[model samples]
Target: MTKMIVGLGNPGDRYDGTKHNMGFMALDLLAKEYQTDFKMEKTFIAEVAQTFVNGEKVFLVKPQTFMNESGRAVKPLLTYFNIDPEDLSVVFDDMDSPVGRVRLRQKGSSGGHNGIKSILTHVGTEHFNHVKIGIGRPKNGMKVVNHVLTKFDSEDNSEAQDGIFKAVDAIKYYIENNDFTKAMNKFN
Candidate 1:
């Protein structure tokens, strides 16, 4: 069963509310709904919250190592906990998927996501669970870097609010049942 959940995003005020930080935002909402709070942990380079979901211990982690190097925070946590790859689920933003859409996968390659690439390098495998939150591609052939770092405007923000909540619910369901298929069916 899954035990650790890591949300990938750059840390700090500058990235706040941007498309790339959607993972962090969704995880924060999940933590709040569970009545828990994250504490900064020096070793992991992330804010971590521990709680039980349906009697299973769950760790909610937000990497502080910036987006590209997110695995620096995740690898150690997995090692310390002795968690299997299947027990670690990463949530992160996806440029290809349309905004407000979510995709869940049992395991796969990073598909060019730097954060997931780093994690795969650290963990030595592509077999791990992931929750991909869509941020949508930018118009006019804009660079993905610029697109992801941009903040959502009013209309996008409204859509995101609802989307984030749905992602949170999906996480809860996954933790409780270890059923990614059910989660995708329900939330996708």
Candidate 2:
């Protein structure tokens, strides 16, 4: 079965390397590991690259609708590709989990993430696959907006990188096995 792996992030250089863009970061690594470059698909308003992993066709996507309206791009791509929610996987940032922690789930609520919320709205279901790249909660006294947009400190940056890499591995495992429970058991 074909699968779509979406990386949700705001579109622009200003958001680059921020904690909120962990999804995009992980996609970049996954694409690089697959030896490909993203081509902007204006029809979907997203960057897309295609590759095969363990004989499964994988389409990597990065929505360009900013963080709040990512569904506009995601929903269209899912429909156009005729991919079921069961065959769709997404990678995104999560503040509740500690940095460097990556969790793969068959499905879940958005947990207050606007991007994931929008995606759920457009996709019309919560029963989809997801890989959450942990960004950690804001330190006391820091605002959520500021904390998510800010680059991590030197120490935390390394951990976040590790998390993204782990997410990449999880994606590969999920594609190869088509088993979220097994992938989560091994990687989460």
Candidate 3:
């Protein structure tokens, strides 16, 4: 049974609303809509919100650790909850996809996402579900780091919001049906 949903991002006012924090923003919206509150949990190095969906217990998590260290928190949570890799889902930003797109995967490599890389490194596997929210690429060949940390412009804000909502829907579908292919076909 799926037990944990982790959102990857850096923590701090400065990072809020940045493209890199899209995962956290999406998860926050989900928590708010579900009327759940995330409480600080040092053991997991994250803020966690608990709720039941379709009669299944779900842990909504936003790691407090910086982006590159996200896995440090995730590894322990999986171990503590006795959750297998298949039962975990991670949400994170992707620069390759357009701002309005969301991609869902059952299991795959990190695709060079530092946050995901960190998680995989700690957990020693890449076989886990993931929802990748698109933030769009830079105008030119700008560095990915700078591009991801930048805030969305007025033109991109609406698309970003759309992506977040779609991601939430995909998560819901995943929990309700355990059908990753359906979520991917519907959302991606």
Candidate 4:
């Protein structure tokens, strides 16, 4: 069975380095490690990359439909690939977790995240896996929208980068072992 790993983020260079783009950033790290690259798949409205982990086929995806509308791309990709929701793992930012932290959940609600909400709506379930990287909540009365759209400050940048690396490692561990529980135990 092919495992589908998805990272949710807005498309374009304008969104690069923002807190919300952590998902995309994590997949980029994995791509570099695997010596693979994403090619835009217009039909799916996503950037797709194929690779192998312990000889298991894996599809790395970055939805290009923007954040709130992620389902627009994800639903089609999963349908076309014929991958079950159970075989899907989504990585995205979580404002509730502190910087430098990553959390893995086998199933859960969106926690008020629009991207996850979209996925849940289109995918029709929350039974899939989640890999959430902490972006922390807005600081000093900063608005939530601005907090997610902006790049981290110098101090936060390093911590955020660390979280991204950990996320990538966790995903790789899951793909190789084919066990979500073990990956969570080892990396969460």
Best by lDDT: 4
* Model 1 agreement with the true structure over 28-96: per-residue lDDT tens digits: 998998899999998889999999877778999999999888888999999998888888889888888
Task: State residue 153's C-alpha deviation in candidate 2, in Å.
Answer: 0.8
> Global lDDT of each model?
0.87, 0.91, 0.89, 0.94
- Candidate 3 Cα misplacement greater than 4 A, ranges: none
Model 4 agreement with the true structure over 124-145: per-residue lDDT tens digits: 9999999999999999999999
lDDT of 2 at 53: 74
Error of 2 at 36 (Å): 1.7
Q: What tens digits encode model 3's per-residue C-alpha lDDT throughout 1-188?
A: 65788988889999999999988998998899779999999877899998988888888999999999998899988899888888889999998899968998888888889999999999998888889999988977888888999899999999999999999999988878877788888887
Model 3 is weakest, by summed lDDT over 10 consecutive residues, at 174-183
Give each model a TM-score: 0.95, 0.97, 0.95, 0.98
CA-only RMSD, every prediction: 1.3, 1.0, 1.2, 0.7
- The segments of candidate 1 whose C-alpha lies over 4 angstroms from its true place after superposition are none
lDDT of 1: 0.87
Cα displacement (angstroms), candidate 2, residue 65, comes to 0.4
lDDT score of residue 29 within candidate 2: 94
Instruction: Report the Cα lDDT for candidate 4.
Output: 0.94
